[model samples]
Target: MQVFVTGTAGFIGYHLARRLLEDGHVVTGFDGVTDYYDVSLKRSRLAALQQYPQFSAIEGRLEDAGLLSETLERAQAEIVVHLAAQAGVRYSIEQPQSYISANLVGTANLLEAVRAHKPRHLLMASTSSVYGGNTKLPFSERDAADAPISLYAATKKSNEVMAHSYAHLFDIPTTMLRFFTVYGPWGRPDMALFKFVSAILAGQPIEIFGEGKMRRDFTFVDDLIEAMIRIMPLRPELGQPLQGDSLSAVAPYRVVNLAGGHPELLMDFVAAIETALGHKAAYTIKPMQAGDPRETAADTALLRELVGDLPRTPIKAGVASFVAWYRQYYRV
Candidate 1:
């Protein structure tokens, strides 16, 4: 299958595109390569994909309305996977406009392109941040995601609404995967694991937010990619009730929680990283910031039912793999 994938320069996108190419699928990657992190990392990811004959990449923002349509037509994409977005919760507090432009406006444009082209399967990403302040121990697909604590989460929730509208009106088969705290090799710099690893390696004190009380369902990139590909041909049908909730009854779209379904404490995760790097982190405990949740755990039953199993990469192994990659990438 020929696939059109956005954010091929990103961490998950880079891994996903490589896996797809390895499986003998032709992929057209789209990315803006914003200086959200290191542009060098993005370029390196693209360079790796360039080694594969089946991979093609486009450098542009997703909000570029005309560009997306033209690329979809030119690539003759039968499957569309949209992963590009302005990510970061704390960063959203300062750069709210970035979230609006990429998450909201950009997503709307992608939906329009899908409506025009009518891909067989349209899988876009959502986030566990949408769960908001709800004290739900393990968030399920049926739970209410109406209360988003951060603008980033709100925009992602808005994407779900926008995608559902397109799916319902245009009869587009769409699936939205609510990703948990995803991390691994080629990970984003803004993410906790990356920051912690960088600080520890430099002998700098790591900020332990909320007095190190936060826990997250950190899903490995490869496991998440596996779940995503397995779900490609399992797009939900219209008129089917959404699992756990009936909020999306009008659309042929359903939200699936993609995670390891296990929440690990922040300190525990950091300990694993410290072990991997053979160094302990100097901790500076700080209060939690605005729009941040205390904890997150995924109820991936729906995803399991759809894909027969969910990703189960243990945190220790995942951390070790990331540490090895970080050492090699930076020559630490």
Candidate 2:
């Protein structure tokens, strides 16, 4: 199979591309290698992918419509996975237009390119943040996702609806994955786990926002990739949905959560890092930050139905894997 993947320089994208190459698939990866974080980390991810003969990559932003369309047509991809975007909740508050340009305009161009050259199965990344301001215990895909508190979430929500329209009109089999708080080796520096680990290693006090009371459904990167591969073959059809399904009645599209159903407390996550690195973290508690939900839990019934039972790596073990990778990568 030939797979076209975006954001190949990113953590999730790098891991997924490697897995596909290992599975003997030819993967054409695209990434802008933006300076949103350390470019060295992004370069390292690209370097790892470059080692695989079956993997090739192009450096370009999603906003570059002609480049994206040209790359997609050149790959002749059977499986198209769109993962590139400007990601950050608080950062979205500061730079809303970036989200609009990347998530909105970039995605629109991708859809148009897909419309021109239809793939067998099209999978794109959404976020669990779309269920914003919903007090539902476990956010379900069937629930209304109309109210997005942040520009980032709003853009993703728009992507879902926009994709649904394309799927309906073009008869393209599409699946939108609403990822939870994903964490693992080669994690992004802006993410909480990376910050905690980096701060602890530097003998600096880690900032605990929301007074260490926030909760998140942390999905391991490996498990998320596993789910994606499994679900790739199970493309949605324009038909009646099964129980607990988020399939659209009007389109050959559905939204699935790529996460464990359980949500862990912020402090518990901190404790896991402590257990992993064997260092007690000094904390500076702070009030809840803007553009963040107090807690996010996923209802992954649809996911389990589509992809069987998830790997559900425990927070402690996941943290240990990340810590080891961080130490080895940075020689800390």
The model with the greatest TM-score is 2
Q: Pick the candidate with the highest lDDT.
A: 2
Q: What is the lDDT of candidate 2?
A: 0.93
Instruction: Give the TM-score (vs. native) of candidate 1.
Output: 0.97
Per-candidate TM-score against the hidden true structure: 0.97, 0.99
On residues 260-311, what C-alpha lDDT tens digit does candidate 1 reach at each position?
Answer: 9989999999999989989988989999989999999999778777778655
* lDDT (Cα, 0-100) at 156 in candidate 2: 95
Report lDDT (Cα) of residue 101, candidate 2: 92
Candidate 2 structure quality by residue, lDDT tens digits, 79-185:
99999998989999998889999999999999999999999999999999999999987999999988898999999999999999999999999999999999999
Clashing pairs for model 2 are none
TM-score, prediction 2: 0.99
Judged by lDDT against the true structure, how good is candidate 1? Answer: 0.90
